[model samples]
Target: MMIAIGYMLSWRKWFDEQSSRLIAKLVTQIALPAYMISTITHDFTAKRLLSTLPDLRFPVLSMLILFALAAVLIRVMQIKEEHRGLFESMFLNSNTVFIGLPVNMALFGNQSLPYVLVYYMANTTIFWTLGVWLIQRDGTHKQAFSLKTTLEKIFSPPLLGFIVGVLLVLFHIQLPQFILTDCSYIGGLTIPLSMFFIGIAIQRAGIQNVSLNRDSLGVLSGRFIFAPLLMTLLVLPMPVPILMKQVFILQSAMPVMTNAPVVAKLYHADEQYAAIMVTETTLLSLAVIPLLMMFVKSGFIT
Candidate 1:
């Protein structure tokens, strides 16, 4: 609902053209990190982090399985060379940082942070490596892949914030009272700012432009349907907490990575298609998330 309001405001020009990118940057670099640091420190302890290590492997392993599945699907579907990278990315990665963070926080509160970051770490690792490679490989110019660029992307502000938070908790370091309070206030901006950015994205993409074609349907299924279900099957048998399974399902159903279009544009892939898919999945998630939560609360899946 807040995201819809943001989109409506952007569509009405209440936010200027530059506002979307500005909000995205603010959320990604500043607000997100602050929120992450505050949440991680407040909620996670060294003992808990060590105990949760076993379940942490599932996110990364699930992502790898999905990537392999996407590859086979892409080949079977015979997706055009131009769209192959975007196709793989849409299915393989998710907007775990921007959309997943706020949604999980809303649904499960601060306790969801450790699980969210576990997924984020896996998501970030794959997105930087295989995700980047896919974009570059399908790009027209075909620039040689650089290790340095990949490392820089993996270690972006958001990931660094997670790392720092974990370290602080592990080392039992205390943040200054004023600094912690300040971070909490700033971090609170992440949800609103992220939602506002999504609105701007939809406005820029023009909601009418979203086409429910075969490709779009395939991408949507891969994200909201297949990914979550697959994760459920994989995690259900494990002795992990039910909240872990719930958080994984929620994050899996999140929208396509918001950066899909940006990465497509950067690597000279099909930017238009990427943008359309991103917007389409994001809008759909407004509906899908609530419905999924109902099932979660009902214990329908356990």
Candidate 2:
């Protein structure tokens, strides 16, 4: 529905390229950070972390392993260097924040939030570090790697919001209720705004530009199928509760991160391709989610 809304709005000219850029800035820099702070502070606690941390490590480790696998697969497929980063980032990362939270909430209710945060930490950490590097390296102009510049990009507003939220949890500090309320109100816009940006981008790029080629097929399959399978195997043996295991698998199965095109544009990579991947995988997830639930019910995923 969000993508549909974005597409319709763009078709109607309510949001063009310039307006879309502004929306991207607000979502990534302001709204996303605010949302991160609100969710992390509200959901995370040291006691909760103590219990969930061990299980959380499973998801992080699984993600790292998947990253390695993605690198190998990209090499085997001989994907061009320019497109490699986008492929790797798309293949390994999932939409943990935007899609994972709500899906988990619906499937497991409010009690599952801490587990979602666990996946969020892993996803955010990887996304900014490795994900940003991929975008920059594959960007329009390639340059020698610099640790300092990379660090600057990685420590973005969203990550900072996460860090501050973690600090609050670590120190057991509680801000006044009114402040949390304000953050909540501001952060709530991230998803809708993000979808709107995608909508505008789809219009600008034209849906016909999105092709179902070899790379696209590889990406869609990797995100919706193989990634989850690999994570489920890694998660099943963990000592955590069953629900935690399920959350990790479900989060892994989510569509490609919605911010892929936004980050691609920010770093000057193939934003058109990135936008296509995001749009296609997200639309396909509506079907994939239900199929995954069936697997879980049949005890195939566990």
Candidate 3:
């Protein structure tokens, strides 16, 4: 598997710590944006795009409910004060782009991408604003909100790519065939690179350090249980498309944000603790997906 290869390479000294960061940069800053453009343009039209935008409310509302639940669970779970914010964040946000994108595409194919992006749009915006603030609260170092920085993160490369792809569709603009092909090739790297980054991160972060205490379990439950259950309850009653419902449920169950540790470290919070949770949740997600897909495909969910 791609993850095993990344782990093996790291173990054998072919990849150092910087390898994961560089790969993450290459994926997020380059590959993913290209992927967004390629998929959006090919798969979406203006009418479909307009309809999808309002469905964004499903994920946004789901997260708002999870946010409230996170606040309560942190207290009930008695997560350490120093790490409470990161715990709250990890509880509410999912890895919508990293693990979520590849897994959804693998399970549901490219037709699922527009809905995937819809979830990503809501997920990314909330994580950068409210989620970042919460993690910062956990840290000893406090930073005032910077509109410029916040805007930069919120309008991240992938989102911008989605925006560009939408504008092209909405305005009936078409790129040269060769340019789209070029983007296709570059975008092809996103999924494999993402897997590689995770494997490398697990190796570097010492999966041995992962602890299954209240903090980890609470987050695990939030991702695997509360998040998906809530999404299912929401969209199941709504008149959404089946594929959209599928995308929402699967994405809601994705692992915690891969950015958790980065934000934790950025604010001098418990980066080690953050990294451990990221590893545990991500690793568990691998196991949960097979049964999850089986359940979803069984028609028990709709």
What are the root-mean-square deviations of the candidates from the true structure over C-alphas?
1.4, 3.3, 1.0
Candidate structures ordered by lDDT, highest first:
3, 1, 2
Q: Which lDDT value does model 2 have at 62? A: 73
- Over 1-302, each residue of candidate 1 has an lDDT whose tens digit, in order, gives 77788878987888876777788889989988998889889988899877776776888888888888888888877777778777887897888977898888888999888888888888887888888788777788677778888888888888898888889999999999999999899999999888888878888888889898667877898998889988988888877788888998888888888878888888788889989999899889889999988877787656
Best by TM-score: 3
lDDT of each: 0.85, 0.77, 0.89
Clashing pairs for model 2 are 6-199
Model 2 residue runs over 4 Å out of place are 39-44, 75-82, 132-140, 258-270, 293-302
Question: Once superposed on the true structure, which residue ranges of model 3 sit more than 4 Å away at CA?
Answer: none
Top candidate on lDDT is 3
Error of 2 at 221 (Å): 1.6
- Candidate 3 lDDT by residue in tens digits, 1-302: 88889888899988897777789989999999999888889988899888888899999999999999989988888888887888888888999887899999899998898899999989988999999999999899988899999899989999999899999999999999999999999999999998888888878978778878888899899999999999999998887788899889999999989888899899999998888888888888889988788877888655
Candidate 1 TM-score, C-alpha based: 0.96
| Candidate 2 least-lDDT 10 residues | 293-302
User: For every model shown, what is its TM-score relative to the native structure?
Assistant: 0.96, 0.81, 0.98
